[model samples]
Target chain A: MTRIYNFSAGPSMLPEAVLRRAGEDILDWGGSGMSVMEMSHRGKHFGAIAERAEADLRELLAIPPEYKVLFLQGGATAQFAMVPMNLLRDRTAACYVDTGIWSGKAMEEASRYCQVGVAATAKAGGFTTVPPRSEWRIDSEAAYLHYTSNETINGVEFQDVPDSAGLPLVCDMSSNILSRPVDVSRFGLIYAGAQKNMGPAGITVVIVREDLIGKTIPGTPTVFDYKKHADNGSMLNTPPTYIWYLLGLVLDWLKQQGGVAGIEAQNIRKAQKLYAAIDASAFYSNPIDPAFRSRMNVPFRLADAGLEKIFAAEAAGHGLVALEGHRSVGGLRASIYNAMPEAGVDALIAFMADFERRYG
Target chain B: MTRIYNFSAGPSMLPEAVLRRAGEDILDWGGSGMSVMEMSHRGKHFGAIAERAEADLRELLAIPPEYKVLFLQGGATAQFAMVPMNLLRDRTAACYVDTGIWSGKAMEEASRYCQVGVAATAKAGGFTTVPPRSEWRIDSEAAYLHYTSNETINGVEFQDVPDSAGLPLVCDMSSNILSRPVDVSRFGLIYAGAQKNMGPAGITVVIVREDLIGKTIPGTPTVFDYKKHADNGSMLNTPPTYIWYLLGLVLDWLKQQGGVAGIEAQNIRKAQKLYAAIDASAFYSNPIDPAFRSRMNVPFRLADAGLEKIFAAEAAGHGLVALEGHRSVGGLRASIYNAMPEAGVDALIAFMADFERRYG
Candidate 1:
């Protein structure tokens, strides 16, 4: 069976090993005589699976005891509202940095719950760069300072954590989480959809500092309340059991790849080579500022906009696919997350050189 | 591989055929060179998978044209809040029929959004029966009349839809949605978690009348708003793509089993035989009213209450597992959802007879 190099951002390609393990365990997981999908979330078999997944994630990120790791549903979009709902805690507003589409969406959702302040924005720079931390306006009265570490659509990323200026720091780390390690203690809450670096779609991972929970705004659904989920071990309701199992498999595979540090080295190499290839070609141009270019999603444009579709179509024919950029911005994008192998990038670079020779 | 009969209430047994198909497609789906998990929600490959799944479901239930089907996240627990958030509209109150645990939970959540009036309740009868329709006091001024079609934990199910007193009927069909056909046209909204009769855990299905959406409460998150999801075809954000595909597989398998009508016959036979066995035995008893007994979940008790644990353990030893009842009520339960084959039920009956011979 031929498995192509898939580049669709979020719900992107998983480690082949994880898929193989899942396929093997789909019918009967480890002699339990039940598929992971069929096992009760409260059953001992799944209980062990859930515990190990959380333990491995904690070890990989070095999460502190003061934080609670929750496997929730409704994705980061749910968390967009949940963050303000649970964190607002008698506060009137929260600060957000507008990096690109994702962060803008988060800001808009949060506005429904509380007054949202744009402390820093890259919109003036066409979303190609992150607004400098020095230029951010700190709002002391704000409940928390929020940002998207990487913008999947705009291909912009923060090189380092921005100072929250004493406010609790919250982050939407959907695309770049686990591609590298970060101090978990720095953030009050970090939420991500599992469709990206974690595993697949359906399950969302939320790591929140304990003190920030328990104060959901009135009328918040109990399921949307962090304290309820945290108190219940994220099983406040029957979690997406099979997806959680698959995410556990991905975590197991990640550990085999030398953990986050090991994957980070590969991720850096893959991004650097792909960026260099685009820089060397006159036919292709990436618009993001070099300092802020996302290592996860690399969006680029063909010199002739008309050929973008052809470039993507031909790339798919060569067993490479999902190279088209976000619909909002018409271009080509290659998302090289942790699961994307360096060989995939090398092959893409080679294909680009050949395409340039023919079309230049 | 010894495939045991798993009787989990939800996140319960899936059709073995569906599991086999999923295992086969886990690596490469339909020659797409990507696992269904890897396909972007917007990509054509998954777009087709999503559309066909919805079409098949629509066909199976014979859903009317005015209703929109949404595959959502966060299970029925999320729906408990979303139902009131979206359907309350400009009304300040809604009527709820409290049948059992699930219905009670739905009522508690709805109370957070609006004035919740109990139209009827089975609690007075120890939740062993559905309140007669003649006793129901559904308020004409209330926005809607909500009820649980079946209680997975309480093992209570309504034999027929109750009169909504002309109010829009809203039902939570989580545990028994596809076990039988229902007149979808009668409901303003019907929601179910995919774990039991549909497929697996992770995705929630909402079948809502078009007129019921687009009027969410002031602070409802966009993802929680049915209008936003229905507008985007449940692609408001990346859905649990792989789980959706698996649900499609279950729907495909259900069609092969003769759609809902065919399965309803099997479900009826299974429930009747099991209940008959319980009724004939002096050592076992099911407290739920005969008419209200759930076809999906059967909860029973041992004459010697202390033997309940021993009974469940022995059942597991005989290739039957998860026979223990909900922690709240504590006895024994066998959730024979649509996927639970007739042979499995026969085996369970034989095992029960043998156990009684040994211990009675």
Candidate 2:
């Protein structure tokens, strides 16, 4: 079977080696007489697997000793609730940056738990650019400052770490984690959903500083409390073992590919190649200001909006799939995550040029 | 590689056919040129897969139209928190039946959101048997009545549906959801973690009556609220796609096995054979009362306590694994979920008899 170049925004392409390795072990993992899916989490095998995954992730991210890496469930959206519940810490309101849909939604969930103060917003730029950090509104006594490091839907990324300045910085890094490196000690907490660059769609990775662990508001559910999860090593209840195992394989693959720096170089090349192709052609356009454009999810619009549907159809016909942009934006998107080989980007660029010539 | 009989409490064995099919498609699924793991949950391929899975499950359980099936995350323990968060409308207390560790934990989580009233307790009996229905203390003004159909850790199951009167009865069938037929109309909500008798360990299946969807406390997080999830079709934010797809395959396997009833017969036979072998041997004993012993999980002890470790090691040598009981309870436990073929049970019995002869 011919494998397609999948450009799905999340749940996008995975390393072919990872998939191949997983398939080989689906029946009997490591001669244990059972699939990884069938192993008990408390068993030594899965326990070791989970430990290796956590250790590998820490090595790749250079997470500080003061950080606790939690392999949590309920996705990053759940973190939107959990962050406020745990980090509000006796304060009534928190500062939020509204770069796009994800951060906006996080603010909405935070509103349910505590008062929300808008620190910055990119809505005036149609969410195609990040608001200038110098102009961000901040409250001196706010509980924490929250932002989205990368907005998957709008394809806008924080250009550099924002200066939270005396306040705890919390970020939702769902769309771009593992595609590049971040200084882990610079922030109080960082969270990412596993579908995009980490692994698959079941687990969420939360890296919280030890100081932020145990402070949930009164009446918070034990499952949502960061302290409880960190205390138990993310096995407060039975964890998503199969997904955790799969994530470990991906981390191992990443380490083989030379860790975060190695993959980041490839990601830069893929984004540059595809973005260069879009810029060279008069028929395709990217709306984000060049500096803030995301290297992971690149959303582009056709010169003729009427051709969007046909463009996606033709792309799929050529073994290219999931290039349709999110419904919120009525154009096309190519999410070139770390797993998307540079060759995949070349394929996408070639298809775009041919389509432009035919329909431009 | 040899496939052995696995008796893990959760994340237990799956059907060989199911595992084989999943392995084959781990690279490219159903000629779609994309692994199911890489597909967008909102895309056409995964949407069809999700639809077919829900339809097959509804057909298997005979769930009524008034109920909506939610494929969720955070496992069943999350549901323990979600149950009280969404169901306790105006009522400040809920009734709970405690049979084992799972039920006991559920009550603990529920107590954070509402006042918890213990209707019955099996702790007095060492959680070996279910408390009789006549002995339960019912609370007239409680929000709802909750019970675990099968306790995974304790190996206890409710023999018959307890009379809930006009109250909405919620059942945690995490360990034995599809192993046998049930009248869906009799309960307001039934939830199962998709590990034991369903699929993998990432997704949780929640079948809630339509009336229970919209109610939650005023401050409930959007992700934890059932109404928001139902409205978004469980794409509230990227449902665990790969686990959900794997579950779809298992649901299809169940259909081919003549749905639940056909598997129920096989389950009964496996339980009877394993139990009989233990009863006939003077060197082994099962503590649960006969009428309420779970067909899915059977825990037993060697008459000589000192031999337990050697027996487990010897059993593993003979291709029988994960027979160690939960740490809370000592001795041995064999979890023969639907995926374990009768041949596996026979192998386990044969292994046990050999161990008894050598070590008795």
Candidate 3:
């Protein structure tokens, strides 16, 4: 069977080893006589799976004792509202940095629950750069300061954690959580959709400092409350059991790859090679500032916009797929996440050089 | 390779055929180089899968043209809040029929948003039966009348839909949605988690009348609003792609098993035989009224309550697992969902008879 190099942003490619192990375990997990999908969330088999996933994640990220890790549903979009709902304890507003479409969506959703303040924005530069920390307006009265570490659509990323101006820092790390190591203590809360660097869709991972929970706004749904989920071990309801199991498999595979530090080194190498190829070519141009270009999603434009479709179509023919950019922005994007091998990037680079030779 | 019978209430057994197919497709789906989990929600491959899933489900249940089917994240627990958040448009109260724990939870959540009037309740009878329709006092002015079609924990189920008393009817069919045929036109909205009769644990299916959407409460998150999801075809954000594909597989398998009506016959025969066996034995008793006993979950008690634990342990040793009841209620429960074959049920009966001969 020929497997392709898939570059779809989220719900993207997973480690081949994880998929192989998952397929083998589909009918009977660890000889339990029941598929992971069939086991009850409360059952001992799944209980062990859940515990190991959390423990491995804690070790990988070095999460502290004061932090509670929650596996929730509704994706990061749900967190857009949940953040304001659970964190806006007696506060009138929250601060958000507008990096791209994702952060903008988060700001809009939070507006429904509380006053949303745009402390910093990259919109003036066409969402190609992050507004520097020095330019950010500090709103100390706001409940927390929020930012998207990586903008999957715009290909903009924060090089380092920005000071939250003394407000508790919250981050949307959906597209880049495990691609690199981070200081968890710098943020009050970090939320991510598991579809990217973790596993598949359906599960959202939330790591929050314990002190920030329990003060949900009056109208928050119990399921949306951090305290309820944390108190119940994310079993306030029957969680996505199979998805949780798959996440566990991915975590196990991540550990085999020498953990986050090991994967992060490879991630940097892959991004640099691809970016260097784009910079060397007159036929291709990436618009984002060199300093803020995302290592996860690299969006670029062909010198002739008409050739962008042909470039993507030909790439798929070579078993390199999903190279098209976001529909909102018509271009070509290659999202090289942790699961993307360096060989895939090298192949894409080789194909680009050949295409340039013919079209240039 | 010893595939045993699993009787989990939800996140229960899946059709072995479905599991086999899922296992095979985990690497490459439909000869595509990428697995379904790797496909973007917007891509043509997953687009076909998603459309066909909705179409097959529509045919299976004979859903009307006016009903919009949504595959969402968060289970029925999320629906408990979403039902009131979206349906309580400009209305200050809603009517709820409290039959068991699930219904009680739904009512408690709804009360957080609006006035919840208990139209009828089986609590007076220890939740052993459904309150007669004649006794229901559904408020005409309330936004909707809500009920639980089957309670997974308490093992109580309604044999037929009750009169809504001139209000839009909302039903949580989480545990027994596809086990039988039902007239969908009668309900304003019906929601079910996919773990029991459908597929796995991450996706929630919402079949809502077209007119019931587009009017959410003031602070409802965009993802929580049915209108937003329905508008985007449940792609308001990246959906649980792999889980949706698995649900599609379950729907396909259900069709092969002769759709809902065919399964309904099997469900009846299985439930009847099990109930008959329980009734014929003086040593075992099901506390739920026979008329309201669930076809999905059969909860029973031993004459010698001390033997309950021993009974469950022995049953597991005989290739029957998860026979222990919910922690909230202490006894034995066999959740024979649609996927639990008749052979499995027959085996269970034989085991029960043997156990009684030795212990009775």
Give the TM-score, chain B only, in order for the candidates.
0.99, 0.98, 0.99
Candidate 2: what lDDT?
Answer: 0.90
Question: Over 4 Å off in model 2, which ranges?
Answer: none
Per-residue CA lDDT of model 3 for A1-360, tens digit only, reads: 899999899889999999999999988999999999999899899999999999999999999999999999999999999999999999999999999999999999999888999999889889999887889897889999999999999999998999987999999999999999999999999999999899999899999999999998877888899999999999999999988988999999999989999999999999999999999988999999999999999999999999999999999999899999999998999999999989999999999999999887
- Residue-wise lDDT of candidate 1 within A177-233, one digit each (tens)? 998989999999999999889999999999999998998898888899999999999
The per-residue C-alpha lDDT of model 2 at residue B86 equals 93
Best by DockQ: 1
Tens digit of per-residue lDDT, candidate 1, span B157-213 = 988988888999999999889889899998999999999998889999999999888
TM-score of decoy 3: 0.99
Residue B234 of model 1, lDDT score: 94
Residues B285-309, candidate 2: write the lDDT tens digits.
Answer: 9999888999989999998889999
**In candidate 2, what are the lDDT values of residues A168-194, reduced to their tens digit?**
999999988888888888899999999
Tell me, per candidate, how large a share of the native contacts it keeps: 0.85, 0.84, 0.82
Clashing pairs in 2: none
**Ten-residue region with minimum lDDT total, candidate 2 chain B:** B151-160
Q: What lDDT, from 0 to 1, does candidate 1 have?
A: 0.93
Lowest-scoring 10 consecutive residues by lDDT in candidate 3 chain B? B131-140
Every model's DockQ, to 2 decimals? 0.87, 0.85, 0.87
